[model samples]
Target: MSKRDYYEVLGVDKGASERDIKKAYKRLAMKYHPDRTQGDKDLEEKFKEIQEAYEILTNDQKRAAYDQYGHAGVDPNRGGAGFSGGADFGDIFGDVFGDIFGGGRGGRQRARQGADLRYNLELTLEEAVRGKNVEIRVPTLVGCDECDGSGSKKGSTPTTCPTCHGNGQVQMRQGFFAVQQTCPTCSGRGKIIADPCRSCHGQGRKEKTKTLSVKVPAGVDTGDRIRLSGEGEAGENGAPAGDLYVQVHVREHPIFVRDGNNLYCEVPLSFTKAALGGEIEVPTLDGKVKLKIPQETQTGKMFRLRGKGVKSVRSGTVGDLMCKVVIETPVNLTSRQKELLEELDTSMGKGEEAAKYRPKEKGFFDGVKKFFDDLTS
Candidate 1:
């Protein structure tokens, strides 16, 4: 039987590009592949025909000759540059399925970068707001001094792997399917150290504690990260070291709770000072400042001290300090204090007149009386 035209076999036009040819070949090959066709001889022959057509059209020289002189220019029986032992099945497989399986054509491996490291740094609120220089000790891998991070002995060097010939990978074939995997002998490094370094033992790195000083910027809050470049574990085989991230966790303050840029605190006020009004000292980060309390000040009244809070690190804007006053009742009274209190209560009068002295208390009873009156009626 006469053979079909290569472009006709692959369902593409004569002027089709190599990319379009490959695409058509892949689609037809998958459809009529021997495995998919279940050992049908006619379909298997079609698969072989598709492979032969793809091989001839994809090769630049053979394709050029066939384009000018047809199949006579590429037929081996007719003294033409024919299929050289069929198509490179490995190349076709890689082009079609390499991305799905994460395997591709083998080459020398590049140096691997070191892993990043994180250090949780605890800071006081004062230090976080004001900023300070802190020294930390981190245990990690450092490049070997003896071998200069090469993993070889002091005077020697690494040699190319014998198994993969410095390709760092080996090809495994099962019938027509080909897969590339890391070379077992070299462990995918492409190079082998015959004389291992005494210090690092062929690993190219050594574990040691490193002391580094970090400058904490002012106004940095909790959850902030400070990056120190080239301070993480040393890279494999002298590659670039990774970065060290200093994670900030500010400790809770005894007097103040910070919220974003603002600081909140509860100030205890004596009932006498709250009722009569007075100038009281309030605690701030810098120092103590006097805040005047107005007459008849109630509990939970918030007083704002402008610019007494933290300055924002990103925006450079200052915040306020919110002081919520909590009225403290007089306790541990002596007989004389009790008599003075009794006299004061007696002077405030009783019933409707006493409502002026204790307005909230009278309002509560008034609401209770209306509730019962509605229920009865």
Candidate 2:
């Protein structure tokens, strides 16, 4: 069969981007792989055609040569003195996975790093403010003991893959181009296990739970992550383990709400206590302390207790706790108590000047009357 133009064979323009070429090749490779098609000769021929088109289009020098003199000019094995070497499998690997997979363009791959881990830590408000040492149980992937992560049988070691010659890559020649890519045979690990280890099932890793003690610093808030090095999943082939990150989350407090470093709380005072202000016990993290209220202290009045809040981890500065008072309306009142309150109300209702102590209450009533008048009008 006469060779089709390489671009025409791939169904792409000659000026197609490298990405487009790779995408086209990947699609064709997956669709027409010999293993996928079994004994189908037509699919195998189509696969070969795609491989040839990709081989030429992905290369610069071979592509330049082929553009000038077609396939005859860039044939590496044609005994042509002017033709340079074509693409190798390694070249394509560097373009595809890159540093993200840490599969670099180095002559050989370095030791692979272990996996990272996440550990969620719960803390109470007191513990978060004062700091605590906690023991956490974590599930991790550890190296197998039988073969020490070699993925081999008890008495044997893993063998280098013969298909790709232990380079973990294979070279496929379609026409004028030769590209280096990862060896599909070994999945780029450069070795294969004939008799897989029964414990880890050839993956070279095992599941294990380990306990670790972590010290939470004082004033650490939710969303703060502390990194513990070499505490994550163990790597294959004795590679270094990755890091473990402990993410802090503070538990909800019944008494206090946190705003940054400051703590806020609503403290309740009875009507008599609010009317005739007196010292009352208020709750604090440490213990109860007597707080003084001026005579005739009103509801919603805030009292700041300095140094009763957080000592921030970053700033190391102490914050304050703000306590707002809410005057309790004496509900479920006894008959005598209700009668006495009605008598007091009659006394206060005698003159507006005598009811001067209830300015906000009077203003609210005035606003209510105005609202009624507006509604009626």
lDDT of 1: 0.86
lDDT of each: 0.86, 0.79
Residue-wise C-alpha lDDT for candidate 2, range 320-347, written one tens digit per residue? 8899999989899899999999898777
Report the Cα lDDT for candidate 2.
Answer: 0.79
**Candidate 2 residue spans exceeding 4 A from truth:** 1-112, 153-157, 194-198, 365-377
- The residue pairs in collision within model 1 are none
Report the C-alpha lDDT of model 1 over 149-182, residue by residue, as the tens digit: 9999999999999998998877777667676777
Candidate 1 residue 346 Cα shift, in angstroms, is: 1.4
Best by the TM-score measure: 1
In order, how many clashes per candidate? 0, 11
